[model samples]
Target: MTSPRKVRRVVSLVPSLTEAVAVGAPGLLVGATDWCVHPAGLDVVRIGGTKNPDVAAIAALRPDLVIANEEENRAPDLAALRAAGLDVMVTEVRSLDQAFAELERVLLAGCGLTAPPRWLDDARAAWAAPPSAPYPPRTAVVPVWRRPWMVLGSDTFAGDLLARLGVRNVYADHPERYPRVPVAELRASGADLVVLPDEPYRFTADDGPEAFPGLPAALVDGRFLTWYGPSLAGAPAALRAALRRAGPVPSPRRP
Candidate 1:
């Protein structure tokens, strides 16, 4: 393992990891994927998208360490970077607790920092317990994409995030992590609410709500629901507010 001083130049392939390292130690990041949009006005070389990063470009930067995530990046891409002799650190964040632990590893252990940033502490405190809601847990379907209609299934970080906010994903028991079910099936799943996010598919009031005529749909910030980084600090409040506005659902409209 290289010393802290030796790990100065870093490249981040994952958006959340990029934001974590950038917020923790901005000067350390030399190159990052185009999708690393957090910490707005970040002035790093664009390496490409998370799925298709410019390996040669990243190699050209000669970074001391390249950060990645198991789900956000492709295995072959990480392998290719390693094949070129670049040190790549991959993180796995399946749950909120895992996210906190991995953030510490990346920023402190990987970035060679003595301690985690204050936002990490703030994030931990923000989601320490489930939010106090007046109504009972609402069954919801969180769609990440529209084409072929993929929804959040069992064991997803987003599912756990919503669960913490008192919203239960109807498909949380599905065998697949992200299952592609037809729109008809999703509408008939008995979900009282549909939580739409503005990412991975960019669902909006005009775009996604019409699918379920009478079901209450909550349009939320995808960053808070999906991204696990400094944003986690405000996620609890933001998500609670969105769910609050969803109010109650009406009877399902007959075809």
Candidate 2:
């Protein structure tokens, strides 16, 4: 049998969770993403990105622990970090339920123990029953990029996220991991919201407007909505906030 783990100070390799832990679990993070702009005053050392992290820079931080995701960081990169004598914890989250479990695990590692707050279970339960009245399910096509256009299809974390938020996925019919298709397919999908993500490929409203003329399109913070890491604890609440901000869709009323 293997021995237990220990953690003192940590560096989060995942950008979305960097802010969540910065706000949710403070003073424990010593390293974060260059894109991690939360907390306003806390200065965290940058350790490159989820894809191409600077191992030398990370070694300089001298952290006792590191957090990474299976889908976010490639296998070779994770192997390199492990070879460097850094205790790395890797998580694979394919659904919102798995996302919640990841956040709890992070909390356990950060605190050097494995006890979870009771409220977490309650929080997950709250989502099962929508507050007030249930709104009409909105069909959304979340595009991560253009040019060899990619979209979140069935069995993906992004697709599961939409299901949790009461939004139906327009690309549930597609079977590919990240399919490349034409704009003509999008026009035929009849999606209510053409959500443009900010990462992998930044989609600005100006770029997608003409492509999705009559559709309700918006540039959304992809990390918060999609990344399943320690930040997942805040995602349900964040989704609710986004739903309120977007308000109700006038056109394409519920069928």
Minimum summed lDDT over a 10-residue window in model 1 is located at 129-138
> Runs in model 2 with CA error above 4 Å?
1-6, 110-114, 117-126, 131-135, 228-255
lDDT of 2 by residue, 1-255 (tens): 333356667888876567556655667799977766665676988888778899888878888878888877788887888899888888777777787777777766554545555445554665566543125777877777788778877677877876777778788767875676678897778777676767678877677646877776656667667765444555567665665455465465476
User: Deviation in angstroms for 193 in model 1?
Assistant: 0.3
TM-score of each: 0.95, 0.80
Pairs clashing within candidate 1: none
**Candidate 1 Cα errors over 4 Å, as ranges:** 1-5, 249-255
CA lDDT, every model vs. true structure: 0.90, 0.70
Report the Cα lDDT for candidate 1.
0.90
Q: Could you tell me the TM-score of candidate 1?
A: 0.95
Q: Residue 36, candidate 1: how far off, in angstroms?
A: 1.0
Which 10 consecutive positions of candidate 2 have the poorest summed lDDT?
Answer: 126-135
